[model samples]
Structures are given as C-alpha cells and as structure tokens.
Target: MEEWVIGPRLYNCYKCGNMICRHDDIVSKTFQEDRRLITGLHTVADVYCCDCGERLGWRYIKAYEEMYKYKEGKIVLEKFKLANENNW
Candidate 1:
C-alpha cells in the first residue's frame, strides 16, 4: 500500500473541522485531478464530514474494490490538527 501521509502536511475540512478518525464519515462524490502519471486505476471520491456535511478532499479508490479504507465509505485522511497551516 502507499505510504499514508500525516503530520504537518495534511488536510482538514475547514468547513466543519471534521477529522478523518470520526466514526461517521463518507465520500459523497467523485472529482477530477491531474492524472498524468496515473494509470486510471483509481476513482476520486469526494469525502465529507458526516456531522457537518463538509468536503474533506478527493480519495483515490482502487478501481477493482471500489471501497474506502477510512470509514465504512470514507477515506482515512491524515488531517492536520490545525487549520490551513501547510495546506497549499
């Protein structure tokens, strides 16, 4: 599996302060990305905070399984503790 990113360089849903560890979470949509080096083996999922309905980010799900590793249907994001620190 790919190295799970965390720490200083991570994402936090500013709209709702939803961390990826929350019990209730899910990816609500699929968005586009710069897939130049990618082999189209993944589907981008739009993650959100279940409590506040805030967008987290796009998830790269394996094409074969079509499932999420974070929650039941959410991606396990290494969200930054604070807001918009190194998010650029």
Candidate 2:
C-alpha cells in the first residue's frame, strides 16, 4: 500500500528561495493596471522580498470604492515571481 501525505502549500521567492507566504493567504488574483487592480481602482506600492529585495508585487494603499475597502491594507503577490514550495 502507498501512503500520501498532504502538507501546507507555500509560496517562495523565485530568485532567493525564501519563504514568502502561503497559498491559503491569497486574497485575490486579479490583473493590475497602473496603480489599480481589476476589482477596483486603487493606490498601491510595490512589495518586495525582505531577504532578496525582489519585486514580488504590490500592497494596496487605498481603494476608491466602498465595496473594496477591505483590500486597502492587503497585498497582491505576482504569480510569476513566486515558486511553489514543492517545486524547490
């Protein structure tokens, strides 16, 4: 018989292999334009990996719409800049 084990999925920095976050922590995966995300226009600042300084994505500074207010203090990580922990 074979046994399978499931572990917590994680996201790591593509360049430095430093642990960045967990897959479950993701809030949304929407396209970004200028300083806005697809859900609503927002003011954002670039987020970086503390260990490598690689540009990971951006943190929302402000959300213009009332419905998106919850996203104001959240962050969005670029999928391409992260590697699945299992891959490494």
- Winner by lDDT: 2
List where candidate 2 sits over 4 angstroms from the true fold.
1-5, 29-41
Looking at model 1, residue 36 earns an lDDT score of 44
User: Which 10-residue span in candidate 2 carries the lowest summed lDDT?
Assistant: 28-37
Global lDDT of each model? 0.46, 0.83
State the lDDT of candidate 2 residue by residue for 7-88, as single tens digits: 8899999999999987777766565544435677788899999999999988889888999898788887877888988764
Tell me how far the alpha carbon of residue 45 in candidate 2 is from the true structure, in angstroms, after superposition.
1.7
Best by TM-score: 2
The residue-by-residue lDDT of candidate 1 on 1-88, one tens digit each, is 7996655533346666544442223243232335341444555676666768766554555554333233333343434322453545
- Backbone clashes, each candidate: 1, 0
